[model samples]
Target: MDIRQYLDSTYLKTAQQAGLSDAENVEVVKAAVAEAIEENFKLIMIRPDMVAIAKQMINDAKSHVLVGTVIDFPEGKSPLEEKLAEAEKAIAEGADDLDFVIDYTAFKAGNIAEVKQQVVACTRLGRKHGKIVKWIIETAALDDHEIVQLSALIKNCVITHLCEDDYNHVFVKSSTGFYKTENGKPNGATVAAIKLMLENSFPLPVKASGGVRSYEEAVEMIQLGVKRIGTSSAKAIAAGEAASGGY
Candidate 1:
């Protein structure tokens, strides 16, 4: 299969987490953008701050590779205004796709309305701007039942508030690859978790992120009906080598 088209070659790291200066972090993002261009990957997912430089580089290269960024990030506790402001800034910086982390904590607390509101607001912002928006539900933080329920919740919001044809403009993504799990549990995308998402969020598409390394794993996700795989190991997978979990 032409897996590059299904890959969102990604590198979303904070300056501190990566243990690098801000400038150094940009360098890493730049290198990833260069690699995406070389590999002809579908999109390059990076931090919002890197959007401008990545946009410039992608434009200069005259490449069709999309520039995407995270919103509300690993934590989805940001107020609506803050998330909207962050998303606007990224779009203005030339982002083509936005991955939004929904308020799962609220959902778990039985605040169904609040969770739906978050999805509606974020999806509306991205759709209005003609940008793709994927909701990161952070599967690691939830059990299977929560995954199905939330996935269905997101799909319902997308279908109800947005036109049915706008499904491709949005997605129900699996994880952030950053949520810590107790007892060393799987923190990213898993086959079972993804299967639950796919079953509930059909027609909305799905982006599998976190813990996916190597060609076999990536292919498995793709074959299971995911439209995208977010990984820092894109190059290794494409080279037919095992990923070192660089994501």
Candidate 2:
């Protein structure tokens, strides 16, 4: 993807290095994100815990970088109210975008109605705040049919409401860094799901995440039509430094 077109300088829980307290972790994340911006990163996805700090960092920076926050994070089982609260809080903290993890449990259990309801709630809330919402489907856990169904649902919600155009607002992301295949790669199912989103002309972008750590893989994802990316390896890629030992 050429690194800049679709990169969310991500700092998920899994991306945290070991042995740092929450405050220290926030500092580390801020430094990393600052570096990412200096290198021309377009987006920065910060954990909710780090939202306030991230916002401050972005404000102090000389360049403009889109700031985002994750809602319902790795596990999407939080109550709808909680998810909405998190989204609102993030927006209030100056996040320009919201990356919400869809309720994978409900979707996997075939509770289609509940799944849509949760996503719709977050999407509507994001709209109210004038913030872009990117639904993280955790596609690694979904079968092909479910992935297609989710894509269709997002399209319906966003298009029916006449939200912002594709490039300007909203997106469907593929994972939450919770699962990977046996080969230590991000589950292929997530990539497949993103591909489905692309083929269907969904009005939102697609963010590929979880286990994306190298330049080759990043380029491959962009080639696959991923418009956004969530990765902790942004600094290395920007510096043209390959992942240690070829990843």
The candidate scoring highest on lDDT is: 1
Write one digit per residue (lDDT tens) for candidate 1, span 1-247.
8899989999988889999998888888899999999999999999888899999999999999999999999889888888999999999999999999998999899999988888999889999999999999999999889999999999999989999778987899999998988998998999999999999998899999988899999999999999999999998888878976667
Residue clash pairs of candidate 2: none
Which ranges of candidate 1 are over 4 A from the true structure?
A: none
Model 1 score (lDDT)? 0.92
- For model 1, the run of ten residues with the poorest summed lDDT: 238-247
**lDDT tens digits by residue: candidate 2, 158-210:** 77665455334778877877655565645522456668877653657777876
Candidate 2 positional error at 230, Å: 0.9
Note the clash tally of each candidate. Answer: 0, 0
